[model samples]
Target chain A: MYPWIWRHLPGPLPVRILEAVVLVAGVVALLMFVVFPWAEPKLPFNNVTTPQ
Target chain B: MDPPTEVIAPVDDYDDEYEDYDDEYYEDDDYYDDEDEQPAPPPDSTARKTVRTIGELLITAGLVILLFVVYEVYVTDLISAGKQDDATQALDDQWSSNTVATDPQREVKYDLLDGQAFAKMYIPVFGPDYKFSVVEGTTDKDLEIGPGHYKGTALPGEPGNFSVAGHRVGKGAPFNDLDLLNSCDAIVVETQTQWFVYRVLPMAGEAAGWAEKQANPKCAKVSPLGAPYDKTVGQEIVLPTQGEVISQVPHFTGEVPAAQQAALMTLTTCHPRFSDRQRLIVHAVLTMSYPKAPDFVPEEMKES
Candidate 1:
């Protein structure tokens, strides 16, 4: 599946690999720094404790 | 041409075969080119398309559930751990600045700011590394910082129940192992100036009788709740309706006939580890307290 994406990417082999790495790192950074923090409060788990 | 005609038969057969091969090659190339241009046709049936849509939706749903779990189990812990460290550092700074007095009689009280650290809690059974900063409120925002001290409850070392609430499965799970506490285990609460050590009490009927005795000193000698003094360790699960678990005397369902004097601590967390269906309550009575000095450490903290 990843190879298919690599083949579709508009670059040579080395450039495609580098692009994939950069893409993956960008996704992880977004999730860790932005998406997760934004979605954390909206999640149901931590808010379970009712205020007394 | 005339010389070839005299020497050999017409090469029409060979030319026809070559033309046929060329036509076949061109047709195959056209087929591939068409595929590249317009892929396979979509399924003709609406039902098939709907099924594909449903499959995509299910995959998306699965991914969302996975991300939610990641957010709950890992991301929240990471964020809360950072918050806990910040709160601990702030508390340490406040202590070092001599903002809190060391007088044993003086009870330091904060203005009940949300997410503000007010105390530090240590459970000896959880080992030396198990310490959490206790913040000022039980709201989600406050608990995300650490275990939150229930506002209006007695402060640590005071003559009433100092109740605290923390998440059992997320937000660093400060009270994740509350159920592991055995009877007589020390749950030490440290304010800026003192360490208040409380011992876990018995569960259920014995706990109720113990509270009754504490509330009414006359009942201490004749209570039927006789689980020997050495065996008060028991576990109890209660629903959210049982708010009295945090009362000055835990399990005392009725109004006390006299003023309560025992300094107690109640740690409450969601029961069944990760579920919020019920509450797990650990009631402990203050056993000893001492003023914080430069080199003083509790014996419980020193043990393995």
Candidate 2:
């Protein structure tokens, strides 16, 4: 479904942007949910005050 | 490894034969068999090869973790707390000295606009022995006891830009909370002689050395009650003109409307704590301004 959407969207330019957004979001969500929390306090720059 | 069984058997047979043959037979056979049994225990296991490699990896990991923890917990807090303590100790020592303790002296006197302010800032939160002179209307260099008055600016009492600078961490971070100052908090400037009260008025970026220009605009004759001010306009009250200056760091410098000129007491410190990419500015106003009363005076400075 995603590949189809990437190939044909309402606008050619906007579709590329949309595709980029999806890629970035995937990376961020992966880091936050899978990589980061698992790393716990050991994560880089996680020492100081963190978001409650 | 144990000797072959055949070799040990022969040696044992020889001994038995000697025992049966008697002393004469032993004397005839001149060969001596005095070797100790139970060969020296095999050298300790050669396991260090693996252990060394593992040890190195653990050490590296431990170092990295330790550095991260220290930076997070101690570096920032220690710097701030140490600085505060130093400032406080400096004040306490000043008061405890025989000069201050023996006399009834009032170094700081009262005033409304520029009379009563922070006569001096003593950060007790820094450390036990850390202290620096806070000259009335002087830069960090003038203090001459470590922190100095900033070069090329007005003294706290005179006007213009009553600029001061101190460390954010190390050498007793006197201005660590500089970033946290809100739009209107109290910034009192008191001196051993008198007090000069002022309000905070941060400048916009591009206006100039805004951080170094925190002073009482009321004393400078710039009016918060004067004509309506347009921040974009190049207006002058008493601060030095922003020369053709370029900074390695970025700063905010918008002008304060004439009406808001007397609304703040600005303070600034290096931004992000560890990086000098920008400055953390806090704008505080004068809340309470009064002289150190005779009773409040340090005895050392009092007249005999």
Q: Pick the DockQ winner.
A: 1
User: What lDDT tens digits, residue by residue, belong to model 1 across residues A9-48?
Assistant: 8878889889899987786677767877787666544433
lDDT of 2 at B269: 44
What tens-digit string does per-residue lDDT give for candidate 2 at A1-52? Answer: 3434466655678778987788757855565446533553343221111110
Q: How do the residues B88-142 of candidate 1 rate in per-residue lDDT, one tens digit apiece?
A: 9988887787654856566675645778897898887788899999999888788
Worst 10 residues of 1 chain B by lDDT: B223-232
For model 2, the stretches where C-alpha displacement exceeds 4 angstroms are A1-52, B1-65, B68-119, B122-148, B169-173, B202-266, B283-289, B295-304
In model 2, state the lDDT of residue B101. 26
Prediction 2 TM-score vs. true = 0.38
The model with the greatest lDDT is: 1
Predicted structure 2: clash tally? 56
Candidate 1's DockQ: 0.16
Model 1 RMSD in Å is 12.7
Would you list the C-alpha lDDT of every candidate in the order shown?
0.73, 0.40
